[model samples]
Target: MSIRTNVINLTEFRNARTGPPKRSEPESGLMLGKGLTDQTMIDLIKKFSNPVSERDYRNRALLNLMYLTALRAKEIVSLKFSDLFLAPSGETLISYTKKGGKLAFAVIAEETLFFIREYHSTFEGDHAYFFLSLPRGNQKERSNLSTRGLQLIVNSWNVKTCSNKLIHPHSLRHTAASKLMDLAGSIAVQKLLNHSSPNTSSLFYTKPYFNASKFISWE
Candidate 1:
């Protein structure tokens, strides 16, 4: 039997605020916190997602995919080309074994698809994984990009801009959820974030700073 609690921890926020976490900070200011604010997330997409150079293409695609799908950090790194296909509804979707070996689905955004196609068009070599590490001196190795590597790339986006919040990759997931909650409430957010229950989704939205708006529609 699964036990569930739908309580919000008001005091937990105060406790968390008492001290800086005893750990490494964001490599490039990826922007994690109570949650990244909505406008800041939009600003991030606009600033970094250029898809110009090989590295640009990869980072741009990665950022857009992270925001669009709201997949977990490990799940994002675990994606393969074979996982994506056209759904009967004519929407592009990815099907894969999730945690606990459960089958799952996530819809891809059109902007994400465009960025991915640009990435593929510019990428140097093929790999089993969809995204690869552009290791110096030997780019074609097509090594599986580790979750830490993905974290660095994502955090790097805000390095130049700088932020008060210490950003993490999961910040993208929360940013997506905050936006989704404003647009579709907790149930829709539960679907996007793959929470076991809508209450979990609501809990995330209840975070003090997660006042997001609209949905994933970037121009």
Candidate 2:
């Protein structure tokens, strides 16, 4: 279950507080929480893979692309062939609708491009959707994966990989935002994530600043 779900019982907590929740001071000498490294992400991709056939491979590719692009699962499910473009510098561009139906573009890795090509060639469905669903009994159509289906895929992979970290499809979006903040600082992350306000961006970018007084000498 998500930590957000366990925060408070909405029915019991009716009163709104004027002040924000209190935060604890960080330990003077503890290592900070680390974001998932690129190597760690690569391992996660491999861990989610199945040896049985190419179907799992396609799913993994979709997951990777979603993470790499920092796209919401709905945006991913809504993607089409025309939404992808190859830049002159060999980068793959993933274009999709943002909040408010605004157009946004994210640069994808070369491997994601290759996998997308493979999926397109291997897919047997006539649907215009990028990620085609496996036919269900009496469904008689290839449909786009639902948001719930995307969550199930993430949950299943998390279980199979023995990763207890509460990683949802949205976690990838958070992961990308966190990494961007770590790499380029808050301003850049704010722009990339398309946050309307710096305050909103700060929620993801700001961390507990560690302080130690032992090193200082008073004159």
Using lDDT, give the best candidate's number. Answer: 1
| TM-score against truth, every candidate | 0.73, 0.66
What is each predicted model's overall lDDT from 0 to 1? Answer: 0.73, 0.66
Q: How close is candidate 1 to the true structure, as a TM-score?
A: 0.73
Cα lDDT tens digits for candidate 2, 1-219: 676665665434643643456686543211123334456667777865652344676676787787677778788778777777988887777788888889887787887777766666664545566676666876756677787877877766552211336556766776676677667776776666767875566665565563467677686
Model 2 segments more than 4 A misplaced? 1-42, 48-52, 86-90, 125-127, 137-140, 159-165, 197-199, 210-219
Clashes of each: 4, 0
Q: Which ten residues in a row have the lowest lDDT in candidate 2?
A: 27-36
lDDT of 1 by residue, 1-219 (tens): 223222335456656787655786333212234456667777877876554688888878887888788888888888887888998989989886677878889998788878777777775565667687786785456678889998888777763222356667777787777778778888998888778998767765744443356655567
